[model samples]
Target chain A: MEQILANGLYLGAQYALIALGLTLIFSLMNVLNFAHGQMYVFGGFVTYTVVAQLGLPFIVGLIASAVVLAVMGALIEKFLFRPVIRKSKRDESTMLLAAGIAFFLDAVILLLFGEKQRGVPKVVNGVFNWDMRLIMPYDRILIAALAVALIVGFILFMQYSRTGRAMRALAQDRVAAQLMGVDVDRYSMIGFALGAMLAGLVGGLLVTITGINLGMGGPTSVKAFLMIMIGGAGVISGAIAGGFILGMMESVGLTLLAAYGDVTYLVIFVTLMIFLAIRPQGLMGKPWG
Target chain B: MTDQTQTTPIVKGSAMSMNRVLGVGAFLLGVFVLVPVIINLTGRWDFYYTLTSVALLSVAAAGVWLTFYIGRINIGQGAYALTGGYVSAVLMTQYGVSFWLTLPLAGIFCALVSVLIGLPILRLRGVYFAMVTLVLTEVARLTALALPITNGAKGITSIPLPGELSILGLTIIPDFATLENPKLAFYLMAALLMVLTYLVLWRIVNSRLGHLCRSLQQNEELSASIGVNTAMLRVLSYAISSFFGGLAGAIFVAISQSIYPSSFVVQDSVNFMLYCFLGGLGYVFGPMLGTLLLYFGWDLLSVAKEYQLLIYSGALIALMLVLPNGILSLLDKKGGNK
Candidate 1:
């Protein structure tokens, strides 16, 4: 029972962290960024190279992965999305572009890394005992703690920082924000970079739990896409809430159902999506004023 | 100015183009039938199977392209294909139903399922609908895995070849077992089916129904205000789309002689959408061209081995960047693309 809680919280935290990136890009730019998962996988590759191959400290690898992917995200926004965005409908073309980028990155990774899974040894090994009743791994605790820290930090940054506020303003109203001199284009880049960075952070963290591979991007994108939809996309808080809820459910599923866990998780995920899609207001989302 | 306005009109093509389009469509489809036969004459039978698979795949992609015409992004067409494959497999293997008969039955089954689900799910607009569809193929895969009738993870294997197809007393297509290169028979069947399906699709798109669907793409609110029954139109297009997907999958199962959960996966769903997009969603026949190019393109890229995907995806991105409207757009008349 205690193990379930620990694992569940850890999973939820990771889901929240990864989903934060997806939701950020969607809300700010209205670009689905299907390649967001590729960015996450890329971050994992970078961290694996730094820590596993280069024998660097885990902290150094993590920071380096975040910075590198953040820049790549910005570049993608400027080059990939900007050119044809106005030519076609934003929803359709962005999806196609993102899928193209995703396939490209996946192939590149497949060429570079092959299909084998490579693990990054845990940063902090050994277990932590609390009152001799509850034992947990230190790295899992650290991961959970880091996820919370980052989510809070991101929220505060969005609330207080000038650029963050501009992002929020854009989400709230595009034309109004543009009228007030928030360079829509610049803010979009920041949003993509920030979103991609958060996904990279989770990717780096994921190396400790699961080995990274070339094909992780497609499934990761699907799961994250489902998470946002269940939480009623178009809002950050909803993404976080959906993440934790799904995280707990996934932990329970894996613990109880084992091999059939994925089916159960998706079944529950789809049910909630259908329900919320019908409602659209969702549990925590605004009533669509 | 008056001639231009009268010629183009506002909504669909002029009535006079119908016979011309029919003539061109018949000619192109005739080429599909002859091209493989011509290629096979050189002792290269593999191209026959490859092009056959292309036709089958484009049939499904055409369904997705239709949904796109109605301004809906459908990412789950694979679900219907998977379902349709299973439906054919079950009927033929379990009930002793003829394989040819299973084609329309599977299509009708899938079409009904789409309408049953489309009523509520179609209410959601844009990405929400797309995101939900993203789960659909996965859900179908899981159900196939868990369902006893689907025979679990092993999937239904060794599905018998379709019996000889006949009309009245005439045997048009011989049984699959009797053919020396069954791939040849499959190619002919797929090519003929592709031609017939394209005719139906062309008529639908060029007809009043096609105009209504295009109106939804341009402005749903305006179309609805004009009493177009936009919701009903969406549901209708969705049904037609899934029907084609089902027919294609049914044909696919007959060719492969087996059905597995993994056979039609989420990735295939993505590929289906890409085929339509890469073909030129604006044109009714874009999916056909797109599927052909993408199929052969991937085969050509196999030379690169490990670097194939990298080069292929890079090319895909470059193509989209250069021709957002797709390769067919290059041939479009500059000022009047339509």
Candidate 2:
């Protein structure tokens, strides 16, 4: 039970970070950002190239990933999403554009990073054994601590920062914020960049543990969608709660249903479908918001 | 300047006319008679396979288009396609059922399953519905992997070709295996299905049901207040949409004589919506034209080799940006001028 709890907590921290970026962009632009998983994978590759190929320190590699992804996200919003949303009559047109960008990124990632899985040298090396009841690597413990710190830092930034307040207003009501002198376009771009940066940070942090590959992009995006849906779409606290709930479910399901093979995800997906049917707005989200 | 009253007559008569009849006749002649003759002269027999696949893909895209018609972004058509393939494969190989018998059975099964799934999810807001449906293809894949009757990871293979399809005492279609060139036969079969699918779609769009669906698309709350059975319409369209997807999948399995969990993945589902978007979401035949253009365009880009996907995706993004309403919208503008 202690082992499962530890595993869930570690998984929850990372999963929450991934969900945070996606929900942020969704709230700001009402675009689902299908390329989010690709952005995450791109971040992992940036970190890999920096640390493994260039022989740079891991911290520098992590910063490089965040910077690269933020720029990409900003440019995509300005050039692709913003213009498309403005010109198109239908709102769903953005979904097509996002999916196209996802394909474009997947192709780009393949060409640049290749198809093989990549990992960096571990930052720390030692197994933490606690009374033989729970075992975890020291690297995992550090990554989890860093992830929790980042989440707390993000919440603080959103709560107190000037730019964060403007973004919150824009998300709450775009026209109202515009009327109140908020720069709608600029803030939207920033929100997208910030969301993407979070994805990159998580990718870079987890690269040492799970490694990264080209194929992980689609599944990662799907899992992130599931997280956001469970927590309530576009809600920060809900994302964190959904993340921990999913992490706990996964940990427990995997261990208990070990003899039954890979039925955990199937059950979880069905349950999510039923849960969404019962509560379309999610646990914390407003209807259609 | 023309008055509004004069334009109404033109708009009403536009649905049927001598010019429209001739245009459709030309299109039919071009597809059925001219293409095969050109392929024979060029000796590019493989073009048959490419066109057949396009025809089948467009059928599924038509289903996606229907959901879009009802104001839903359906990224779950692949699930129905996969389910249909598995149903047909399992029945033909395991239950000793004939291929012809399993085709409608697959479609009906998919329709039934979709109704069960769509009832609850369809009630959500469009955005929430989109998000929920997005995971459905993955869920279908996982279910396929876990289910024992699906033959697990190996998938069902080596299924027999579609046998002779007949009605009463007449043999309408001969067994595919006995044909001299099954490629041509498969192409004809798929083309026939495509034409039939679009005709039905065109009919539906012109009917009273289609008007209610359009109202739902425009404003669901207003439509519901005005006495529309909004829930039933949504679910009915969804069922019909999944039926088309299932039929397409069943035909696809017959063409390849195999079924696998990975056969219809999430990319294919997204591409179906892309087809509708590329052609023109408002038009009935949009998906057919979109599928033809995309499939051929991809084939043409094969010469790019390593940069093929990069170029293809880049072109797709550019095209969506340039033609936000779709390629057919350009035609609509020119047609409206008259």
Write down the C-alpha DockQ for each prediction. Answer: 0.59, 0.74
Tens-digit lDDT track of model 2 for B44-116: 9989999999999999999999999889999999999999999999999999899989999999999999999
Q: What is candidate 1's CAPRI-style docking category based on DockQ?
A: medium
Assign candidate 2 its CAPRI class.
medium
Model 2 residue A35 lDDT? Answer: 92
Candidate 2 residue A73 C-alpha distance from true site, Å = 0.4
Predicted candidate 2 versus true structure: per-residue lDDT over A181-255, tens digit per residue = 999999999999999999999889989889999999998898888998998888889888888888888999999
Error of 2 at B75 (Å): 0.2
Q: How many angstroms is residue B42 displaced in model 2 relative to the true structure, after the best TM-score fit?
A: 1.3
The models' CA-based lDDT, in order, is 0.84, 0.90
Q: Per-model TM-score of chain A alone?
A: 0.93, 0.99
Stretches of candidate 2 off by over 4 Å are B1-16, B335-338
